[model samples]
Target: MDRAALPGGVLTGLWQRARLVERRIETPTAVTLVLAPAEWPGHLAGQHADIRLTADDGYTAVRSYSMSAPVRDGLVEFTIQRVHDGEVSMYLCDDLPIGADVELRGPIGGWFVWRETETRPVLLVAGGSGIVPLQAMIRQRRAANSDVPFRVLYSVRTPEDVIYGDELADSADGVETTILYTRTAPAGSGRPPGRITQADLKTHGWTPGFDASCFICGPTGFVETAAKALVAMGHDSHRIKTERFG
Candidate 1:
């Protein structure tokens, strides 16, 4: 898309060279890469970048990854989860070295973003690495010192699968996170291991009458289930935004 058609009018379709400045391991299967694009006009919290990688034989692959944090000194961060047998993810998670250069085009997507001016209570639901963009939202909230209330329900297979574990635990005021273990519950856990049910939303999410703005991101099946549950509980479908990856 052209710049006029791009979200926020801050991105272009042309791919720019970006260099990896930092890398951090988020989980066994995920890694966070900080890249400094030659030029960046800034982006919304929930936007993403299309990363292009080329091989020695001239084969190229492109994939989209949500930003895990807000822009800092023109640097952008992406937390990528390695998909089994997936070339792009595997390379990004394991082989992409610091100081290497890659092609990036984005700050793409607009509908799923969160703005600081919003006053409605926010409900964020994420499954697995879907928490990346939502984490950017939380960081933006803190950075802007906006007191918008936020409630997060994060689903993972086990404790080790939770990304940004320490940061989520130490969230600022007006933010809260509830972790739901789908396959393994930790010791002394009161709840049994299970998928997120309507009951879970009712307990951890805003009341239907609160008119909260809901953002759900995850695998396709998980996102669908959560959206359906929220709708069944009377949340306006328009107020519930979703971003899914598989």
Candidate 2:
């Protein structure tokens, strides 16, 4: 077997023992855990990791969660949402205590990452908890003081359901954010609450011919719909990349 042909995780296994140093409640169902890996090779914005949890009886549950920000002072953070029936998610979000140990591997997928060198205008679309990795891009851009003009279209159930709400709000000056509430809207939002539509993308996103790079992360349906819409609006199909979840 060719070593070069080996899968990334197999070649550079991220498997390591890590300690949970901090935790933040991002939302009712989501929590961000800051882990200090004994050995971290570092990671890019939009990368994710595989977390494996073991029970006292030796049963194990494995799940992948996105890195919520660029590596900060040798610490990597994951913002995980509780999936009631998902054993791994449930433990990470609810049962796991600060200072506990867990097995982890990654900075996983490579194709979904964003680089700081690209100067073209960017358009980021996220839905629900899919905002985790995308938020890393926003943070990296700000940290580098890169003048890469970008905008975010975040769709959520309601204002209260928005994670990193205040941070996004405060950083709105450089990168614009348009929140579409599917279930309800806050008072005086003017327009009735709705899902993100073609009109919203056109008005708030880059025009099809603007040479903007589009990154959309969300449920499979949303990604397909948004990708198709971008192509239909004259954007180059190759320039639109997506990361989809259930």
Candidate 3:
């Protein structure tokens, strides 16, 4: 039997009615939803799923959200930032109740994924909610017992705005993690409070000699700026992979 065709519920309906099984508060303004498949289907880390919701009037809104859980897990998670006017986000954050059925189709997109075969040193740059996919990569790498050196530079408006702060800190036990807070002052040693600049990368040990593979995710402006900087630093443009959100 094809794994894809297994009784995972109607692909279209499982794509539609996978309810919000759990929710957790990340930051004051952010929430993470754990969606369980009416029937389980595995997903790959670093991939995203499309979530759709129907209105009482039969209208629907759709949005793509990156999965935060490790691929092997039966449950899928999405860390969402509430956007005032965003239809899906607003629904997920406010109106969607625990156990309320929701629609999703996913384990989608392969371009941004990291697999065991990728042996090069990695450098991840993310801003705001863009850290979602990088979180998956971090978990997958750790699970595979991979020794590949990797680093992440996460930029946020303030310390409070940093998503997965505790998880990222714990994950940094061996891997490098740098947090740049643009709106707040640096709390103590090693924390840089400002927007990401070329100098910030240098201070974080991003050297031209590293020959690293770069993965950048964020808003259009953030991705463009980070990619250009990495390219100017002599990193091969072909080795840089980017996923821009909005």
Candidate 4:
């Protein structure tokens, strides 16, 4: 996944607006947008793009959003969470309409991507909307028919705030998943309702000798805490990769 070559001619065509081809409401707080570039350039899963828009007063705002669609998919999909007081998110969620056009540059970012050749077992940890990039990775792996073992530990404020809840649950039927709810109990199920901790990891059979490569993406503090916990459990730092969202 070469970041420099991504976006191709689209990078030079920033002044031109890319049309929104599709949109889906993922949850009360998030929406997924599918954009078709006037000219489509390939993008890798787990990579992100920069969307820029100019207001009537000539004020320009830009934001980076991770690609939600699998890399093999031709269109670009962005799963965006609405952020209160965020200039770009507010406009995208409240104002952007179907068939609207916006300036975008990328298929950028490399560090977050899992290249196709990677076959090691993967452990993904995400919080809230941070699951976007990891979703891409999971889809990529499934698309490739790769036999890699992968699992996800997704923490959210509550069941209501769990983005991609149904999809993730269905996907977990074939892959492992541990949902941690910080503000709500595990509804109906007898599973313990609490934040992730060392005991939770141990109970889930996550141990040092699993030969798994860990990828953690979430709010900065949660990611740091999870990483430290994994490290304390004797997982190699080199085997752990992380992306933090503020």
Pick the lDDT winner. 1
RMSD of 1: 3.5
Predicted candidate 2 versus true structure: per-residue lDDT over 1-246, tens digit per residue: 000111353224757988999999988987899999898888888878877878899997767778888899999998887776876777777778888999878767777778999988999999888788899999989888888988899988988789999878875447888887889999987657877788889988999778999999888788888888888888998888888788
Which residue runs does candidate 3 get wrong by more than 4 Å?
1-16, 171-173, 189-192
Candidate 2 lowest-lDDT run of ten: 1-10
Question: Poorest 10 consecutive residues of model 3 by lDDT?
Answer: 1-10
Residues 1-246, model 3: lDDT tens digits = 001111222222246468678899887777889987666566666777778778889998777777877743467788888877876776787778998888778666767778866888889899888888888888888888898888899899877888888878875545788888877845573655677888767777368788888889888898898998888888889888888866
- Local accuracy by lDDT, each model: 0.88, 0.82, 0.76, 0.75
Instruction: Name the better of 2 and 4 by lDDT.
Output: 2
Question: Each prediction's TM-score against the native?
Answer: 0.94, 0.93, 0.88, 0.88
Clashes of each: 0, 0, 3, 0
Query: Which residue pairs come into collision in candidate 1?
Result: none
Please give the range of 10 consecutive residues that has the lowest summed lDDT in model 1.
1-10
Q: Supply the global lDDT for candidate 3.
A: 0.76
lDDT of 2: 0.82
lDDT of 1 by residue, 161-237 (tens): 98999988976587999999999999987889999999999999998899999999888899999999999999999
- For every candidate in turn, the CA RMSD to the true structure comes to 3.5, 4.3, 5.7, 4.2
